[model samples]
Target chain A: MKLRLRGVRKSFGSKVVLDGIDLDVGEGAVVCLIGSSGSGKSTLLRCINLLEPLDDGVIELDGLDIAEPGLPPDPIRRRIGMVFQSFNLFPHLSVLDNVALAPRKVLGVPTAVARVEALELLARFGLADKAGDFPDRCSGGQQQRVAIARALAMQPELLLLDEITSALDPELVGEVLDVVRDLRQSGMTMILATHEMAFAREISDRVCFLDAGRILESGPPQQLFGAPQHDRTKAFLLRVIDAGRLER
Target chain B: MQQEPTRRQRWERRQRRRSIAVAALSSTTALVAVVLAVPRLPGYRKVRAAFFDGEIFVDTFGPLARAFLYDLQIFAWCAPAILMSGMAIALARTARSPALFPLRVAATVYTDGVRGVPVVLWIYLIGFGVPGLLQSRTWSNPVLWGSTALIVAYSAYVAEVFRAGIESVHESQRAAARSLGLSNTQTLRHVVLPQAVRRVIPPLMNDLVSLQKDVALVSFLGPVEALRRAQSFKSSLANFTPYVGAALLFLCVSVPLTRLTDHLLQRERRRMSATAIR
Candidate 1:
């Protein structure tokens, strides 16, 4: 397994955001977390990246317990790159510099070397022409792609995507999903929190249904999406189907 | 095809011109009234001879202008120190580590203590008290101690301005930087400070304007700067025109700074409104 979470628990004040989240991701596996809004999907991704301190339990990466006290999170975060739903690219930097920043600053790469790598990544994402343009100049879809490229520049072992498509317009969604599809084909391990049921069913190797901060069900995407055993999962999928989000 | 103005548009244009005419007439009348009334007051000639003596202004302008260079010299050194120490203090105050609690407290106390005391009193205390306590000739240089006083007092104000700018940055920016494995210092240096500093440039320019003017206050320590030179002429020559000359010299620098601050503020506002559309 590349990543493991055993009994991960997190709370904000009196509200429990992630209650006993236990999961595993094998090498190059793509796991999709499907849930309604406020089902702890985002918080789970944040905790996994160590953005938020967990209230309880352990998260292991490559068999090493990273949840131990006094463990500096920077190294762990470098290994686990995350793309946020809001596409938080640094607005002050150009798309190229946004991608190059972590490599140059955190990884100690030379400026020219980082720029070369960043330009290559931008070209791969169809953003080579936008290398000099700031994030505000790019469309939402382009910004999100640049954000993904930025996360990938660190060459992370595992990538956590927190509802990466949730903020995108319908017409722009496919481009971003295409990027995810390419990453999967390139054998990058990923955990995605997504609202796009069709994309999750198409791309996910394994699907987990979360409700009220717990994993309600988990299995192959077909088994879980087509034949949900739990009532909550079935009800959630039914609402999604009724909303025309999932093509039944 | 350019269309002619509509009736309502022409009427509004005429109204605007009339309002501008009225404004000009009223302001001119007020100015003429003040100008005509002031000279008619009893003993106006004596007051004018003492304060507006053209001969005294011509005689002292050269010396006072040269002395103004001392103020500029003090400002030149103090400005950089103020910026660096102010930023350090702001960072110290914002640090969240349990271990840095004392540092945070000290920063708070330093800002509060320095800001609470009047800048003039600080000049007196640091300039005179420090040298008196040390009893060293090197330390007794009024220019050195006076410059230190300005730096100490002004840095406190500048630090508060910096802290406000830093706090204005959204927490999500910090979160995004941290998620990329940037350490706290790296996030601050790369992500936070750049945005914060850009946002606060207008306000910082305002502070620099104030600092430029206040540099003359160091004349209290008896460095023969512009204000001191003006004071000496006032006492020895029994005339105040050198003070007026000094005021004009100070305004020469400060007015430009004020105009630059306004230009930056307008540009910043325009940038904000443009981005807000996104």
Candidate 2:
């Protein structure tokens, strides 16, 4: 699905989080949104997934506006999957059961079929054996992989991953990134809000830098990262490199 | 290389053990002195007459035990009624839909109004009031009316406990559940409530333990539950031994429940510490 947002705006009281935002992602494209904290990267993603109501503007899925106030989010949300920075897996559920939950409950798939699909997803994610373990028992990286599997179980047309590996130890981040890499290879449409500039540059077809609740600039990653036009983008890239989140 | 305790450390350990033993001996001696001197006080005879008689203690046991069986039956119906109604009321109170406004208002009113009154008043008002309105001789049974009163009053308190549990679940779980296309109710049933119930087990058990004791208050509405039977024994024999007998029976129920709650709390704690965010 081609996801598009136009003149989108949101605010909490006096503070505006997403100020007249506009963006577009083609089908099967990987768009990485990079910004400093509090620059509305996560908020923009949340608005697209309908987790937050839009204040003003249109969020269109394939040229059809789905952001109407009366439109129920449940059906719209089924087409959009999201992962949080903290990998909020259900603690009370077994990994397998967590993976199976959405399909069985929302989609009305029978338990046996859902579990079979969930186990396959678990096996692919190298979590087949840990399927019976609760989320707390798994490592941060493993838990994130399970989270991805859970979202994929819904077979959403678009996926939003908000700093999925940000909470993991440095050594554990690669496992989660590897799963993202595999999804990218499978032609999955994704929007990622990330601090990992190098990973963003490597995987994203287009990179968007957001600042002060607006997209500062967006273009091919190589041009944006290597020879940025915007002064703000340049300053941001310098800090990202100094922090060693980009290649020297 | 590891070193064993030095001479000073060994002496300190020995001194600590010695002090503990001495403290125990002193406290025991003091307690015994107080116990022995009690008989010399003027009130001692009355105390002995009321509580220390073996014959009255023995005489109170059988009737109180039978009445306690009646309390057990009351508990069987009341506990489940409180749990089910409490959870439903709690869910209604927490619902955000504008369409459910009236229900939300009613649930809030019910919880606040019922909880504010003493349970005893509920026994009087509901126990006597409902039957007075209906004026049905068959429905006027005190046991039935009393148990209903207890359920109504306690369910309000338990509803708040249940609501707290439901709210304690992290917002992230709801976000995740929503992203999965689960409806609000589905999210609560499948994700939030089960975890919330687990977290609330300690507090919920505390309510249950107190509720078991409250079962005795049914006697005030005029049924022959254990406390009523024990009070009758006090009137007839002029002794308080039957009260102790009733207390022992209550301990029999409350102690096992308390231990079970402790066990649940420990397991939850251990699991929580494992995943505790640094």
Writing each residue's lDDT as its tens digit, candidate 1 over A192-216 gives 9999999999999999999989999
* CA displacement after TM-score superposition, residue A178 of candidate 1 (Å): 2.0
Clashing pairs in 1: none
In angstroms, the error of model 1 at A2 is 1.1
Candidate 1's DockQ is 0.49
Clashing pairs in 2: none
Per-residue accuracy of model 1 over B239-261 as CA lDDT, tens digit each? 88999999999999989878987
The CAPRI category of model 1 is medium
Using Cα atoms, each model's DockQ against the true complex is 0.49, 0.63
lDDT of each: 0.92, 0.92
lDDT of 1 at B248: 95
